[model samples]
Target: MQFHHHGYVSSDPRVEPAAGVGVNRPDELPDEIDVLIVGTGPAGIVTAAQLSQFPNVTTRIVERRPGRLAIGQADGIQARSVETFQAFGFAERIIAEAYRITEMAFWKPDPNDSSKIVRAARTADDPTGISEFPHLIVNQARVLDYFAEFMANSPTRMRPDYGYVFRGLEIGDGEYPVTVTLEHTAGPNEGATRTVRAKYVVGADGAHSRVRDSIGCTPYGDKANHAWGVMDVLANTDFPDIRTKCAIQSGSGGSILLIPREGGYLFRMYVDLGVVPENDNGSIRKTSIDDIIKQANEILHPYTLDVKNVAWHSVYEVGHRVTDRFDDVPTDEIGSRTPRVFITGDACHTHSAKAGQGMNVSMQDGFNIGWKLGHVLEGRAPESLLATYSAERQVIAQNLIDFDREWSTMMAKRPEEFDSPSELEDFYVKTAEFPAGFMTQYQPSMIIGAANHQNLATGFPVGKRFKSAPAVRVCDANPVQLGHHHRADGRWRVYVFAPDANAAVNNAAIDASTLDDFASWLTTSPESPVVRHTPEGADVDSIIDVKVIYQHDHTRVDLGTVPAIFLPKVGPFALTDHEKVYATDPEVDIFAERGIDRRGAVVVVRPDQYVADVLPLSATAELSAFFAQNLLPQNASARV
Candidate 1:
């Protein structure tokens, strides 16, 4: 039997899905749930799945959708999102089932005559080489199904339920403040209502969010004004770029985006509504799939377009819109105390699907905030840490809009509308960073302090995620990548990068003095994030986990000599195994390639795996302060 990310075997007989949730009435729900996720799209599933990692916190996810879509909207996983899936231990699964996007071909009319269409440019899909995982195109429904399966096997025993409609949102007086009134829509007990209360509520319910409206939150950006048509078809076409990711602009008709989907001979094509001719009577008319194909034929000109099969298609308006903040402010009003309500994904922003970010962004929003909420509800982290969710994601949301506003305007126009070729091509070149989801940088918050980091690591700077690099382990002499270091577990990783100790005193992983300093902090730092949040009588592993990677030849060093932290121990009273320590000095040192040295640096990585801060091993006080700013001390009351 093969065990997956959270350790449930694929063939496990004990697996129970969301349908196994034992709630048949309002009283059946736990009086206080840790989280109440209001939507079942990419955002809700990712959020619920992430929250399931923390055994101390309970999560309840309810969706209004009657069932999963057989043919859903939004495909194409960005490189950063693929890194996220790698963290979840499912990227390889999706990558195997999805079509890899290698290069994008741009088509435009020749400048001389404006009548002939030609391939203007062919560029590598990921020119920056920032991530090992490339962008991929797969069915959106398949991705959600994987999430559902992962949740079923999770240890938390909570799964998302569909056909449950939220009728009202209110703050009730009790341990759980946020009350969600729900009713089953199409199930056997139709119209049966239940009140589920939670400590926190997240509204990922799309642009028309009922929770956002109830909270008095409003969108503060651009309104949608354009509509586009998309179709998934198996086509018989003479066009050279039929099987490739191509954007073609015709002289007479509007532009079309042809992206090959997973499986053989299937492609999703997006066409501007301007391609469909308007009725001479001047009344509003709906565009059909045949009309889209006709416009594709007109755009191709000499090349023919014939649909061999049609899977699914639709016409929807696209726009650039975003909200001021992601979280709702608290007031003296009845339900706004401990149970705070927040929104993410489409609820916070809406944009054109040109960047293929609709689903990825939604999932990422869930990934970013889920752990933070878990930490707070479990009393491990200060409530102040939650504010960073709004600060970080809102900026990303704005950047998304600014790019979409420009990209959509450019794509909707004809070739003749542009002054020159350079102008249009430059648009694609300049906007590469946003869609790939690599350039997003968060502001300084409680977690990442302004006065803490002085000598940040170059390349992998503080506040940015650690850049990916190829490495090899010292223990097994196996290769590894730096970006794949994290799992869904809610623990911050403190990486001790030390030089190759030619010899060890008492068989330690590094030099005696550095090892002593690290061991002292790891075992007994009062202000350590892991130590600080530990309950008075509760036995829990420290919130921090220590990992060591040396910059020396793997052949020369002793891998088994690492400290007790790297090894497996029976309970708290057994011999430690030396398995977690690794080496990057095997071939060409990965540290050297990434602008670090054998002298080494102590880098702090957040639970989300973003680089929090860096320091010399001797600066233990600075390290202690880093945790004090984010984590709450044991027996401490709410800071808010």
Candidate 2:
């Protein structure tokens, strides 16, 4: 949102002035590039968008499709994804257009009338309030559109190269190690082949990924022997909970997961097709739309659906599969060699969509690899950093598969199978966090630090996404969420929470000597990560952004007494950025809400907004060591 630094913009500020590779970008595929991303799904698009921020890095994404997807199979948008949209600068717009799920109604067979379904229980979408964002239901295509727009407006002006199919790829020894073969799926040179080389290649291609095959990685898991027909339709239904998200189970007609879509009239139904027989030979996929409708009506029993139009539909059997690894480097060669190729999204993990995690988890996969690739390619971090992508995300994908397996099995269960009528609803409420995308907690590794200092900021748990809380900006007196200030710019964040103080009693000034000393050490000390990692001639905060949040109210905080680290000067002109400093809102104490120690704490957040580490104000040395584990010193030569 910050503008006027480059120049006065009469047009929309969101549309960044093109620079670097963005200027007069070539239409044809380049012979060489820093990174090559395959597929334009959620994973691929997000990776491209993140790479677009690093204008100096040559990155491109290719899709086999002739153009953008018209309709996407996925629609559920978890809260974590909404938070990511905020970082990419489009959460509000997407949320406004999305169908927010406030409450989910569960239905079961009525005891008096076993043939009819009755509402069992209605629970809030995010009963635990894990995130500020809402659980949304939006078309996957629209989400891709928003990300595509962000890419176009980025400094790199990235755009997906449609009609280019990833035929295959190989990793060799050299600077551009990944040699990729692509086919022209459309256009005058339809049958022609193109060869390109890249330092790294990412496979966001779906289940049948050619890139995954080339890397010798296979999705390993079994099917649930259950089939479901899903469809987005415009229909009139006598079912009272049709417009509401409902999980329906009839006495004998099977079950239905009815989700209301955006635009009011459109809704989606995942009609259970009953269990497939052993060695069915995929025959259940041949179930017709009419058959699906009949099954849906059967589930509803007394109620019925009069379909007017079908937007999109598909038949998928429940399956849970994940690869042992997500990268080209085999398990035996892990630390000895660096990864040159990677797989993400459905390429590495495939599972039932009942929990609506395929797209959400895939997007996170893109983000995980995107930043690591950017850093390593830009010489900000060592090539070893790339290994963490697979290390971290592979575990998360397995967890998703397990969660989806349980949820899918429960959905397919008969009424008599459940010991209690409320069992399904109880499971739904109990495991709400997983579906909301807040259950991921990265274990300690090169990127994620140990949680020894977690007590300093108990709320911002190490390895989890930084839970945002409201705070008032000191300069403007406007209340803001601290975590919302983070963007997908690939820079680290250091939030310094100063000791408690009563600003009014202290005459508009709280003792900040401790904060000033820490800020001076961070900016001037050679051992400081900020001073050690930032490139010469770059802004002080170009690598690590430092911000302070005081317990005192905005009016009582003295702006002049603040440290210079929080007020960095940057852009074409050395203009001081005063928006970094913040104070606790009088209405809500962020420190208490987020469990920050009253004595003070320093929370280090990764570019993706996950809390990397928490430290006491005096543990500046420990802070330096944490970043040193990942980032290369500015004086070090580029890894190429």
Candidate 3:
């Protein structure tokens, strides 16, 4: 939201002034580029959007389809994806158009009449309140549209090159190591083939990814024996919970997972099609729409459905699969060889859609690799940094495969199989965090530091997404979520929590001597990451932004008393940035809520908003060492 520094902006600030590669961008594909992303799905678009933030990094995304996706199969938007949308600056707009899932209704066979199903329990969608953002049900296509829009508005003005199908790719020893072969699917150059070289290539092409095959990576896991018929329809149903999210289990008929869609009259139903016989040869996929509706009515028992229109429908079998690694680097050659080709989303992992994790997890896959690729391509980090993408995300993909397999199995179970009637509901309540996308916790790596000083800020767990808390902006005295301030702009964050204020005097401010000393060390010390990593002549806060949060109330804090590091001069006019200073809201103390030590603490957050490390204010050396492992010094020559 900061603007007008370069010049007075009479137009919308979201539409960044085009520069670099974005200025008069060519319509035809470039012969050489810094990065080439394949596919325009959820994962592909997110990767492009994140890469678009780095104007100097030339990034291009291609799609086989002629244009944007009309209707996406995935519709469930987890809270974690919504939080990511907040960082991308479109959460509010998307939420307004999305259906908020408040509660989930479970139905079981009634004792009085075993044939009929009755409401068993109604549980809150997020009973544990893992995130302030709502669990949404928005079409996957719409979500991609938002990301595509963000890319277009960015300084790079990126847009997907439609009708360009990825043929294959090969890694070489040259500067632009990845030579990608592509075929034009449409336009005057239709049926023509071309080759483009890239420094790094990302494959988001999907389950049958050509890029994955070229890299010698294969997805290995169990194929589903259970089949389900899914349909998005506008219907009139006598079922009481038709408009609500319901998990219905009938005495005779199969179970049904009814999820309300965005529009008031439209909803999606996953009608159980029973177990597929061995050697059936995918015959279950032929289940007709009429058959799906009939099965849905049978599951409802006394109630019936009169379908008016079928929006979209499909038949899919539940399966769990994951690749060994997400990059071209072989297991044994990881450290010695840097990866030039990468894969994400369905290319790396595949799972059931019933858990609503296919698109959500895929988006995270894009985010994980996108930043790493940007850092290396921009010369901000060493080539060794690219190796961590596979090391970190491969484990997360495996974890997701396991969680979805269990959830899908539970959904396919019959009513009699459960030991207790509440087993299904109990499982849903117990494993809420995993489905909501909050269970991911990356292990210690070069990028993620060890939790040696976890006690300093217990609420901000290392390697997990930074949980947002309310605090007051000192300049404007406006309440804001600390985590929401983070944007997907490819800059690391250093949150310096000041010590508690003295209670002896009314409205007494925190002691500034400690903050001053720390600030001096950060700006002047040669070992400081900010001083070592930042390129010559660049803004002080360009690579790593430092902000301060005082323990005193906003009214008691004096802006002039704060250190200059928290208010660095930047932009063409060199205007002082005041947004970095914040104070604990009187009503809601952020320090207490987030368990920050009353004495003092420093939390280092990754560009993706995960808590990388927590240290005391005095641990400047430890902080320097942590970043030294990840970032390359500005003067050092990049391997790429």
Candidate 4:
């Protein structure tokens, strides 16, 4: 029989096997909960699911909504967010539900005649030639539901409950145990509120976060005066294939964003409230859409604007601001002690919808905080680690604001007149100056955290680093069936780099080697997995690229300090300048003599495929110690 785990059980088990979580009465409250996650959006649910992965943790998510958020809240799944979904074993579901749009169309009105002209076209054509999972268009609810499923199936036996509202919170106690007051939305006992004591509380509630308000935390940033009316229309229209477009329709204040969804177009109409300021805060009303669309038609002359069926509609006021810090500070601050009650997504920062970053940014906010919370809950790290969340995510929030600001500026600039690269350079300079380098890793959340044994300065918690690695099909030429690497368990890996030894040594454990013994080790080592380069052997590229390391470049490094083990032909490598000895010298005469890519170095790869440490082949003891300290130990000494 198949044994499936954590999920909500509704009355109809077949249809809602794990959909609704029964409410926990006030009397039934546990003595202590590992975490109290506020909000049910992308960030809250993802954090709860991640926290529930640890066996000892009991996480409870309190969402005020009576049911799942139904609407076109956030639509696009950025490449990085998709990878994080892969880690949670939900990427497939997202991909299945999403509509794949590879191309984007941006049209601007001809200022002279009011006729539309193609401004720029964007495509996911593998420009970087590295990403495996490109962007996708999935509704925000589906992603949240995946997170809900993940939490329900977690080893911690905790699932998110909808229709539960948080009434109040108290965080002054030394142990950080929070008393969360919650009540169900429906039923006889619906309005009743009960107090729940939790070890930690995460305020993932949106922009106007109740948790933030209760915690006395006020948002800091420049609020936008204009509010945009974004409507998601479900209709078969003329521009079915228009994935994204910055159309400057006639009579416009700000440009409109036309995002073609599955049988729909997510339109963002820039409602001009007059020249208040950039990213100033305001509100949007439904009546404003008709005017906005009218302007859109007038500005964008070529495409006939037709209002079909409106599936979902909402207005959001954009802002450009970030919380000063994420942790505790002087008592004078508004929410100083409430730093433990962290916020993400719209709660922390807000930006214009131009860069198509609303959903992408929200998922990333969750990605940034989830793993760090997990680490802290496991007791594997100190409370100081949690401080990094605000530090890291705040910068990302700032960058998003900056990116949106610049994008708007670029859109405002006349494309035809710009001759010099000055505009691009200015944009790059602004981006480069942004504090959070974490934005790049946000979408693909796959880079592994550096191990303490590797580098102390860069030893971010494992979750942050792990979120950056790519999940791809590690292809092989052989026709035999094989299992792909799974991220479900969240386990890290250590790849031993030595000249191919006998297949016996290819076992899970990495064995260090000496440079001088390299040639002899490959030919004579009973456990060596490395095979000598012969005309009869398998293709060298396939062996190393596909089978051994899987799809990703799982940490290539010089095996050791042994000078003899250094790569035969290398001045430098990407991650480090360390040398790498070839497994078997290639057959190519020039390469055999001049050396080849660093193929022999062994690396300790974190579960997220981040390089933890590079062990020189010469020192087995040192390598063993490094692994023993960082990875889950087979023996009691390393076990935490």
Candidate 5:
């Protein structure tokens, strides 16, 4: 809930890092910039924002739109996305303008009397309490504005080339192999086309993506006879759940979903179009706005909706689809690797908007690639890390397609259309995990494949995001949620869960020598990646952010009672300049609550806060190897 207060930058200018920052910028912007983004939507903006941190990596975005959108296309903000947004430093501003979904009402006619409406079921928005942030509804336009603001303030200063049109993309032999052709929408450069090149290209363009077709990432999925109408309106409704989320299944008419939006009397309504008329090619014709509202009125037979004003409305044929390829380095005539060209967001996948997943998953796709692309360009990681973007994200895209197919179908069909009456409700409850965003897990990839990963002490599985727990800061009594610090910065977090200061080791009990074994392993492994990369007198914080987490009774013991590793010396050869320490609250043991033991653990948390891998203190090999796989060595990083 905490917000970082920063002054707004005046005018559009290249955002340079602070004076004498950690690393020097490249002397010149290379002919082939680090990355070229093809759209200014959620995915493109996220890519720009993340790469902003590493100024050495030059990035640019081109959008065909002439101006920023006054209205957005999506509304649902999943918990997982909110947490990631918190890390990016803008969730609070977004939350201030959003309606957090707490619970839902499933309205159907009473079983005994089919004429009277009744609430058949009510459940918590997140029934499992899986995430800290609940499902929220807000104009995706606001989300995009925030992202655009971040771009303006970014060190890269690649404010979108809005009003610019992308003509074509060609990747051939050259330093900046991916060539993007573009033209200005207006101004002195009107009617003139130019070419921009980059080491990597991202196509965040919409489903009718020119990039998808240019790259041959064909969209393949089912598009049934179902059609839907969505609208944001200001109206008067007598339905009891007017201000709240309601799934109304009328006795005679089709289903209508009503959700109250951000300000005033604004609300969103989803009306089932049943079956639309087919076109000459047998494709369904797009429904008209008037027909959509007519159906909405029909669905709410008992309670009337008197529309005072209409904000935006759209009607479309329902369908699910995903591209086969996300990224590729095509072979030359002799079968050599070409430059990197990739596609994300709608360019890669599209599905029914009923789930409110388009914008959330799109931003996440950008989040996943942002850091990996930064690492590759900065020489902190090899090109192999870039491959995980497609590997990790494509699965989520496919899963979303499958989920949308069922959820949209169930919501569109009448109760009698199902084989059995209860089938509709059963399917809704079963696939609840899709929208939560927590269930999306990346399979084993070069970044995640680790040794002895399954035998970790804490049962928090690798590939799953690290779950958060409440605890108080040791320095101050302020309460801190662990996930709050799972920042989007490129650095990885190594949480070394140490024993209580008063707890026992092999030969000693209730003493300061509690972490003798772990400390020895750390200091002795000087040739390890951490020590090897760190300057002779530098702290390891430059390499990775380290924190020691435990559940010790602070009242019973002082800071000196704990091992020195928990309280590392700051001068030189220290883990961090600022003490990297944390502990559980006296009223609750956060570690034990998460099935962690007093013996402690070494949990490797990825930049995205996924529990990447865990190891025993004794297994220095596993720890070293894990870092080596994900991060570039000292000499390799110097190439930046």
Candidate 6:
């Protein structure tokens, strides 16, 4: 499928028409800036958008090319990336523009011959548990356009100084800042050079990053020599069954995936440039439009080959490497300390385009680091919080790289030529049945939902398997009261397990008579171990609110009941049928099963919704200390 517009606004009128590098750049560049982003790709744009959110921060993005966003580099938007968009208040816009793909169709050739054309499987029919925006099908350029608009609303705006070629950087501990030189590509100011000065810099530059090189950071991993050609087009021809993500590996030549992007199909074909002789020169320069269409059709199956219009297309090699270091540091330091200057997106890691992790990973990287940087720069968070960026994100990136390697290997493996004795074909067939995580791992690892529990006997069991926070069910029939940032307020909310319990009994239990009695008992009884406070004017519906729970518990518990009132704010509140037990501790296993440690009465979660510090029940002082260390003065530790 392809799309062709008879006439459109051409940003580059005097198009030099060079593929990667080796194009003449613009002469003039920005003179001053606080933060300079190196690339104008998704990563670069998203980073600029995020950085622009800070009122004090000055950001400018540099695009080497003089055009709009790429047509179809990547399409899949993982669950986590959706959550991230919500944080920035643009998830809805993205979802509206993109197609919601509930199912992925996987097929092979031949019914009887299970070796090569094994079987077809799909996930569309399965139930997706509790999510509004399940999946989407927007292109990379449109996503960037959304971000560009969002950034425009912010104090710091994105200035599109296109065709600016990066010369080099002047890095030092002293003043003068980092100097970035760029030259104009066209017009009277064409050969003019301009220098930009910024306090901090970001290298959102692509895999072969000039900014990365200037910073002395080295990318780690084996280089993939193979190149793939992708023909992104818009066509009227219909593949009724092709909904969102589709894989056609059983075709005449090899694998051809027709992902249903917005308005048209992003037809990606895995071409072996090494084997194909004509691909050597990298010059489709003189090839007519018809010839290009023919080439694309030949690459895709002949049966499905019918192209009327070609909107945009590009062929490029893949970068299959994860950089060991994102920013340069003194070799003399000898420790993996944080770099004041950080690089993210493709600059940090690059993998095969098969899983479409490129843009997604880049966006996640920005989301992960952008907020942290904002807080630290704004003095809302401790400086030490910045260190957590690499520690958390590196693991995520490594896991994704591992998944891509497996996916790439599976696609490269020609099971048709192999023997049937090993049951290897069965493995691939089962892989088709498994979740998308089995192939991409990035989605499952990064996405909050569908995660398992981590098994740890000691300390704050920090691993990938953290239970997702329950979000406000907006679509549900029940009129549950909801609030802004219901998902990411960094509060351990507790709900009294009174699900549909008798309203009369519930009222009787908390009304004037019983409330006063309970409060008196809590204060006088030596056995009472809970704090006491009033839940006056609180939202008392069955739906849980941390503030409400804390108020109710504090109102009921008496002063002398338990010598020291265990502050509900900094300890695990028991929720069990076993009832209150002052003589014995609550069952640790019960809390552990719920993925919270009972021993650490207090578990502090980061604002991004990940566990940060866990405090033991025995040491209430440590809870105070945890707050002192984890939060800034703005947090108002007294409130916690």
Better of 5 and 6 by TM-score: 5
Candidate 1 per-residue lDDT over residues 1-640, each given as its tens digit:
1123233445644353222232231323455687889887888888887887766677878887787757878888888888888777688889998999988889988777566788998877877786788889999888888777676566575567777787778866667888888888876878898887887899988888988887777788654455677999988888988878988888875788888999958999888766333332322136788887887787776788889898988876666788766877743332333338889889998988877888888887898898899899877887777777877888888888887788878888877678877566676666676788877766677776452433434666777766777767666777878568677667777877775456442465545467656655655666544456656543333466667777666665565565555543422234343445677745556766766534566777787777788776777777788788887778421110
Model 5 lDDT per residue over 442-516, tens place: 776666745364554455667878788777667665567766876666777777777655565565564334356
> What does candidate 5 score on TM?
0.88
| Candidate 4 regions with alpha-carbon error over 4 angstroms | 1-31, 118-126, 174-176, 235-254, 263-287, 328-339, 412-490, 499-599, 602-640
* Cα-based lDDT at residue 230, candidate 6: 61
> In candidate 6, what are the lDDT values of residues 298-360, reduced to their tens digit?
433323456656666565554567776655554454245445566788777888776667777
Q: Could you estimate the TM-score for every candidate?
A: 0.88, 0.97, 0.97, 0.68, 0.88, 0.67
Arranged by lDDT, best first: 2, 3, 1, 5, 4, 6
TM-score for predicted model 4 compared with the true structure: 0.68
Local distance difference test values of all predictions, in order: 0.73, 0.90, 0.89, 0.49, 0.71, 0.49
Candidate 5 whole-model C-alpha lDDT, 0 to 1: 0.71
Q: What local lDDT does model 1 show for residue 124?
A: 78
Model 1 scores a C-alpha lDDT of 0.73
Q: Which model, 4 or 5, shows the larger lDDT?
A: 5
Give the alpha carbon lDDT tens digit for every residue of 391-509 in model 3: 88889999999988888888888888998989999999999999999988999999898999999899999999999988999999999988898999999999999877463224555
The TM-score between candidate 6 and the true structure equals 0.67
For all candidates, the clash counts are 4, 0, 0, 44, 1, 25
lDDT of 4 by residue, 241-311 (tens): 34553344233434555665543345433433233444333323444656655654554546656877666
